[model samples]
Target chain A: DAGITQSPRHKVTETGTPVTLRCHQTENHRYMYWYRQDPGHGLRLIHYSYGVKDTDKGEVSDGYSVSRSKTEDFLLTLESATSSQTSVYFCAISELNTEAFFGQGTRLTVV
Target chain B: QQQVKQSPQSLIVQKGGIPIINCAYENTAFDYFPWYQQFPGKGPALLIAIRPDVSEKKEGRFTISFNKSAKQFSLHIMDSQPGDSATYFCAATHAGKSTFGDGTTLTVKP
Candidate 1:
């Protein structure tokens, strides 16, 4: 219920294509993150940005990339889409140790 | 290496029954444990959280029981209603970052 919104609630892309998902937050939280939610796997962190230009890799950051050039926008890009990379993507924002606020989630599929 | 492991892939309970979900972690460095609930087509929402220092935390019908020595924590829903049925995830934090376990799908039948 926070001010977080994800663009293109659903997307279907072919394999070996380029795709980018956007996450926008109005909360202006200091930390931003991207994660993929899959059945029996929960939510896995892909990439996160601690500041405008400071980003870090997560445990599942193999074929994903991220950029945070502004305070409210973070983008997750799939350089070359794969079948295994298809899942529900979520963007979350958190400040300090408070609960992280999440977007509605973007469901992506690769065919 | 998965730092957190959650059990009971799915669960079913009658209305007003209690539902319990367990989570265990391999790393003792994790200081923060939180539970989140998610509904279909929606994102995960914070339900409750607990620190290692406290053995238990309660908020409304949701309670978090933590055992530091055992390196485990759990969520218990008292008087769980059909509306409380959803996917529950347990997570742990490592230096400002968090990792989630495979969620438990709870279906409370009315």
Candidate 2:
């Protein structure tokens, strides 16, 4: 298993509240990604970072933001939570174009 | 638009049966194809992967058949066991980015 850890394995928050999920890696991979998994949608990329402070938007980046301040930590923030944002989130890390290693996953529910 | 498409939203097979999952991609630039297996409550893990230069590759009882010209790939599990039941995802990668399929839930009944 990869040395990836996601904080707050489960979370429940009210609508319009702020929430942030953390992904920490000990592998020192160059790339880290945030993804959400839903019943029919599979895994949808939310955001990814290539290096410290370098980030890009994924297919479903709306209403979510991410920051990578160091090589080992990547953060995903939802400025205002919504019911539609309820999903299982996964964090993955890889070395440039190689196979990605995923964390256990974070389940967040918005009430 | 989805860059990669997968078929058979779910599958059921008896023990010792062979199960196949198919995936298709429209992007010609995709050079790497990988399959992931996820058990209930766990994140996905890499099961098998293939590069377009080869038509087929096998690891253990798992095989990946690739048809670059047809823009398609498939995973075949030989003599699958009840423990093989899980969700499978197909992915395509290019330039450090990956697109995943909707996923296939496989059930190998005893």
- For residues B1-110, what per-residue lDDT tens digits would candidate 1 score against the true structure? 88899988899999999999999999988888989999999999999999899999999999999999999999999999999989999999866788899999999999
TM-score of chain A of 1: 0.98
Candidate with top lDDT is 2
Q: DockQ of all candidates, in order? A: 0.74, 0.82
Q: What lDDT tens digits, residue by residue, belong to model 2 across residues B1-110?
A: 99999988999999999999999999999988999999989999999999999999999999999999999999999999999999999999987789999999999999
Model 2 stretches astray by more than 4 angstroms = none
lDDT of 2 at A92: 99
Best by DockQ: 2
Give the chain B TM-score achieved by candidate 1: 0.98
Candidate 2 local Cα displacement, residue B68, angstroms: 0.2
- Model 2 sits at a Cα RMSD from the real structure of 0.6
In terms of docking quality, model 1 is medium
Instruction: Give the residue spans of candidate 1 off by over 4 A.
Output: none
